[model samples]
Target: MKRKSWMLGVLFVLVILVSYMAKPEKTQNDLLLMNIEALAAGEDYVPIQCIGTGTVDCPLGGKTKFVMIGYSLE
Candidate 1:
């Protein structure tokens, strides 16, 4: 009886671990939606945009243009 119970406990733990591992990862679109939600909730700052294509007028004067690496817009 004790051996059966130990086996059941191990099985339960294995099931839980398998479910966690099978969970889906968030896509970039999901992240973008989350960011939009946060911005709508006033939890995030507005992203700065460039004024022009040229370096002289780009970055909107005093605004900082951030280049995020390892991030995809897709």
Candidate 2:
């Protein structure tokens, strides 16, 4: 019974770890919204890649690692 309980506890921990690891990171749209908010607040915003063009080589590509900014605006 003690061994079974220990195994169950280990399994529970593994399940939790896997679920946490599989969670998706913040998306490009989320970053863009934050950037827009910053812009509205008159603060400098980090540039993001243009998602509309489906390319990371957009002008603002040099600013951030994610593609949150628009192509034309860059």
The most accurate candidate by lDDT is 2
TM-score of each: 0.41, 0.42
Q: List where candidate 2 sits over 4 angstroms from the true fold.
A: 30-74
Per-residue alpha-carbon lDDT of candidate 2 for residues 1-74, written as tens digits (9 for 90 to 100): 99999999999999999999999996678889888988888635555445454434556443333355534432
lDDT of 1 by residue, 1-74 (tens): 99999999999999999999999996679889888987888523345455423324333354334422243343
> lDDT for every model?
0.64, 0.68
Error of 2 at 59 (Å): 31
**Candidate 2 accuracy as TM-score:** 0.42
Give, for candidate 2, the lowest lDDT window spanning 10 residues: 65-74
- What C-alpha lDDT, on a 0 to 100 scale, does residue 27 get in candidate 1? 68
Model 1 alpha-carbon miss at residue 49, Å? 21
- Please give the lDDT score at residue 4 for candidate 2: 100
Give RMSD to native, each candidate: 12.7, 15.8
